[model samples]
Target: MTLMKAVTFRDFGGPEMLQLTEVARPEPGPSDVLIRIHAAGICYHDVLSRAGKIPRDKPGQILGHEIAGEIAAVGSNVSPDRIGERVVIYQRLFCGQCPYCLAGRQDLCRNSRVLGENGGGGYAEFTCVPAQNAIQMPDGLDMTTAALAVCPIGTSVRAALGVAKIGPGDKVLVTGSGGGLGLHQIQVAKSVNAHVIAVTSSDEKVDVIKQAGADEVIISPDLKFSREVWRLTAKQGVDVVLENVVTNTFGESLRSTAQNAKVVVLGNIGTRPVEVDPGLLIVRRIRIAGSGNATYADVRRSLHLLATGAVKPFIGRVLPFPDVGQGHALMEQKAVVGRVVLSGW
Candidate 1:
């Protein structure tokens, strides 16, 4: 029996529940490929899953979705030529037969399952995934940075560019600007020459957010940033709002947007119900869109951006896989400024 190191959780309460254990290595099916993970990006989703906030029925599940690795083995049906290729795993497992998948919108696949949300997660030495889900990493992109290509970069790209339709000379506002996705979104919005305003709750993140190319950084301790935004934009309001901390900031984000502006909701860290009054929407004509998981096309564009040096990754810390619990603890405490990557399992 082949054994591999994995961070598994049999209980759901806190970061202490994540245990380092030896588990049987998974084998690839005919259309699957086995990857030896080099780096896995820790996300807020993993923290929520550990706390039993995300829906999960079973225990003993590994909790990592952003994986970057080299192909260790390929199934009999897969091409042997793909062995040793560096790749990043797309965050979702989609059924190819779904209507959404057929329309090149796999992000909306009805039968899609998020990698870490169920099982066969990435917080391990080895993980088996469908050959189609493994995208080759672009040259000059390291494994550690590529690990974040899916969630932070790809998702933010979909939110800022695809959903919000950001363009040159546009005024863009980003909430939770110190987070993994927030940092990447700042860069994405800047890539097209948009004026970027970043909002963070912590004063410590103000400098870092400014360094990420934000034109202005606001420390909004009470989530009342719309007034500042209104003043900054000269009462015209911003053209788009990348709402990452949706539960707490959604209403204020809407108030900070110009007429017909789009508010793209990427994350809801509070995991609480949002209060929205439709009257504001009718008067402002603000469009609110929920940007879900990244599509395959989004990941491809993210890799291209990373390869071209258009967007740089901001990782707060990189720890050995045994310290997965510590990474989650930092996330739960909101101490991490950016993404926390785990390696060396």
Candidate 2:
């Protein structure tokens, strides 16, 4: 059996749990493809998995979801042309036979399994994924940007376009606008020619948030920015609110939206309970939607945007594979501005 270096953890804990060691290189099964990972983007979900917030079937799991690489080998059922092609792996594992999968809504498939939570993830030199999940990379795209194209970019596409139904001339407000998802979401909103108002707790991130195409940047240390948003829109409020900080900013997000507006909830960073007023929802007529995972179509659209230079990838730090733990630490501390990618695996 051939061995490859992987970052593995036996018990769910903190950054100290991550261990760099040799593990058996996975072989491609029928209808699967073995990829030599060139770059793996770090996400908050990976941090949650390491902290035991996300469940695992067993111990000793390689944890990473955002991945981009070259197809080293293919299964018997896959085409030979796929070999040596650079590609990005769609993070969700879904059963293609399901109804949702047939409808191109694999993000909602009942038989879905998340990459890092299911089995071997992208924290290794080599990983095997379903052949359908391997999307061919465009000519000018690099592996690092390709890895970020899916989640921060593609997922944001789904949330802004598909879920929120953002349109031209609409006013969109994005909370937690300094992080990976928040920064990309601002650009996604701008792609539709919408007026984007970005909110962040850190003053140091205001310049980068503005650089990411936010029409208005709000530095709110108290996580209360609805009044500022109201003032920015001349008291009418925004048409859409991309709610990234659910726990800290949910109530304010509702308050920041216009009447009959859509509020798309990405994820809860605080992971705590929130108190919402029923009267507020009744009066504002706000629709609260929970965005699911990104689909193949979403990934393709985002890649096109990136290839055409309409959107740029934000790589805050590129760390060697051996320093994976350090990447997690920086992410935990919220020191890094954008995506943290691991290379040289």
Residue 185 accuracy (lDDT) in model 2: 92
Q: How close is candidate 1 to the true structure, as a TM-score?
A: 0.98
Clashes of each: 0, 0
Instruction: Give candidate 1 regions above 4 Å deviation.
Output: none
- Extract clashing residue pairs from model 1: none
TM accuracy, model 2: 0.98
Alpha carbon lDDT of each predicted model? 0.91, 0.90
TM-score, per-candidate, Cα-based: 0.98, 0.98
Positional deviation of 301 in candidate 1, in angstroms?
Answer: 0.8
Per-residue C-alpha lDDT of model 1 across residues 1-345, encoded as one tens digit per residue: 999989898788878888899999999999999999999999898888888887753568888999999999999999999999999999889999988999889999988888978777889999999999999998878999999999889998888888888999999999999999999999999988999999998999998898899999989899899999999999999999998899889989989989999988888998999999899899999888889778888899989888998999999999999899999999888899899999896
Where does the lowest 10-residue lDDT sum fall in candidate 2? 50-59
